[model samples]
Target: SGSFVVAVDTDVMGRGSEELGKTLMKGFLFAVSQLPSLPKTVLFYNGGAHLTCQGSASLEDINALADKGVDIRTCGTCLNFYGLTDKLEVGSVTNMYEIVETLAQAGKVVKP
Candidate 1:
């Protein structure tokens, strides 16, 4: 299958109240995990780093995706920038180069 990827650049899914956006993000990730064909990879960067770290509300859904072989990656610099380097719970650290290459190679890219 072609490389289908999802890039999440923020902790929230959209504009509006922070609470509502976070709720939407949780629901969105859960829905993604339930997809018949999961994305080949999920890239977490910027505020998205929060979603893959410990204490995150979406850890369960993200972990479920990981269990099914989705390549979960969180930006190393972003984590450090956010003081979350030691809090990561579900993915390997990646850099901008890898992120760029992955996105460039992806057949489709979904952002939420």
Candidate 2:
């Protein structure tokens, strides 16, 4: 099968009340963790970086995905911009070059 990659650019899925969005994101990640075949990598940036930070409700699901060998990478610039560099809990930091390269190399790129 072709390699699959995911790029997350938001803290939530839709433009709705903040509470509902976070709830949906949590459920989405939980469902991703339960997938029999997971993506090759998951890239988090912008507001999505918050999902991988400490105290995030989605941490457990993200951690489980990481533990399953999915490459989890978050934008360093994004983390720094949000003052969350020290709070990253589940992934390594990546730069724009690698991010672009990763997306370029993937057979499919999924954004959610």
The candidate that wins on lDDT is 1
Model 1 alpha-carbon drift over 4 Å, by segment? none
Q: Write the per-residue lDDT of candidate 1 for residues 30-102, one digit (tens) a residue.
A: 9999999999999999999999998999999999999999999999999999999999999799999999999
TM-score of each: 0.97, 0.95
Model 2: clashing residue pairs?
Answer: none
Residue 24's C-alpha lDDT in candidate 1?
Answer: 98
Q: How close is candidate 1 to the true structure, as a TM-score?
A: 0.97
Per-residue lDDT over 35-86 for candidate 2, one digit per residue giving the tens place of the 0 to 100 score = 8879999999999999999999999999999999999999999999999999
The root-mean-square deviation over C-alpha atoms between each candidate and the true structure, in angstroms, is 1.0, 1.3
